[model samples]
Target: MQLTNLNMPVASLLACGNDPGVMTTEQAHAAMQLHLDCTVDRCLVRRRARTTLVEAGKCVLDDQAERL
Candidate 1:
C-alpha cells in the first residue's frame, strides 16, 4: 500500500511508538515520512501492520500459556 493510502492518523503512531506490538522503525518511518531507516526493502506499511498484529497475537498466546 502507498504511504498516503494507509490513512493512519499521526496520533496513532505516537500512541503506538513505545509498544513492542506496533510497527517496525521502517514502517513507522514510512508512516510519518521520517526517513529513519532507508535501507530496508520498500514494503507497504499496511502489510507490516498486519504482520505486527499477528505477532502480537502470538505474544498474547504465549503469555496465556505462562499463566496456565
Candidate 2:
C-alpha cells in the first residue's frame, strides 16, 4: 500500500504554501486515497490555531484585540 506512486497533487499544493481549501473534491479524493495507501498504523490531520504576529511573540501590538 505504498502510495508513493499514486498520482496525488499533494506535493504540488504543499510546495505552493497554499492551504488545501481550494482543492476540488476529486483532488481531495486522490490525496485521501494516497494517504490511506501510505499510512502505516494510524494517521491524523488536525488544524493548528491561527495566530498573529503579536500572539506569536514576534511583535508587541498596542491593539491586541483588533489582531485577535
Candidate 3:
C-alpha cells in the first residue's frame, strides 16, 4: 500500500549541479504536495536526499547501553 495514496508524478530529468539542497521526508512530502500536486513517495525522498543509515546491532546496543 502507498503511504498517502495520491497519484505520484514522474520526476523530471535533472541536470548535474555543483550544489544540491537537502530536506527531510516530511518536508519533501509537503513540498511535493504543495508544488507538484502529488505525494510522490516516502521511500524515494530518502534516496534522493542521501540519508544516513545505522546497523541494527549498533542501534540496539547503543539503546541498551544508554538504558543501563
Candidate 4:
C-alpha cells in the first residue's frame, strides 16, 4: 500500500500559509491530523472496494459453463 500517495494532499494543505480562515498553528495541525485520518479511512474503503470487485469477478467466472 502506498501511504505516501495518500498523504500528499495532507502535506500540501499543511504547507500552505496565510489561511483565509485565520486558523492558528495549533488549529492547522489539528486540521492536518484530521485530514490524515480521513485519508486513512479512504484507503481502507478503496481496499474493500477492490476486494469486493475481485470476489464478484471470481463468482461470475465460477458460474460460467466451461468452454472446450
Instruction: Choose the strongest candidate by TM-score.
Output: 2
Candidate 1 local Cα displacement, residue 31, angstroms:
8.5
Backbone clashes in model 2, listed as residue pairs: none
- What TM-score does each of the candidates earn? 0.25, 0.29, 0.25, 0.25
Candidate 4 deviation (Cα RMSD): 16.0
Q: What RMSD does each model have against the real structure?
A: 10.4, 13.5, 12.4, 16.0
Clashing pairs in 1: none
Model 4 stretches astray by more than 4 angstroms: 1-20, 37-68
* Model 3 C-alpha RMSD to native: 12.4
Please, what are the lDDT tens digits per residue for candidate 1 over residues 1-68?
A: 45544455544543323232367544544543442342123433433443454465622335543342
Q: What does the lDDT read for residue 63 in candidate 4?
A: 31
All models: lDDT? 0.42, 0.36, 0.32, 0.36
Task: Give residue 38's error in model 3 in angstroms.
Answer: 8.8
lDDT of 4 by residue, 8-68 (tens): 3434344333232433333334444444544423343322323333454531223332220
Which ten-residue region of model 2 has the weakest summed lDDT? 44-53
| Candidate 1 ranges with C-alpha deviation above 4 Å | 1-43, 58-68
Candidate 2's TM-score: 0.29
The CA-based lDDT of model 4 is what? 0.36
Better of 1 and 3 by lDDT: 1
Instruction: Estimate the lDDT of model 3.
Output: 0.32
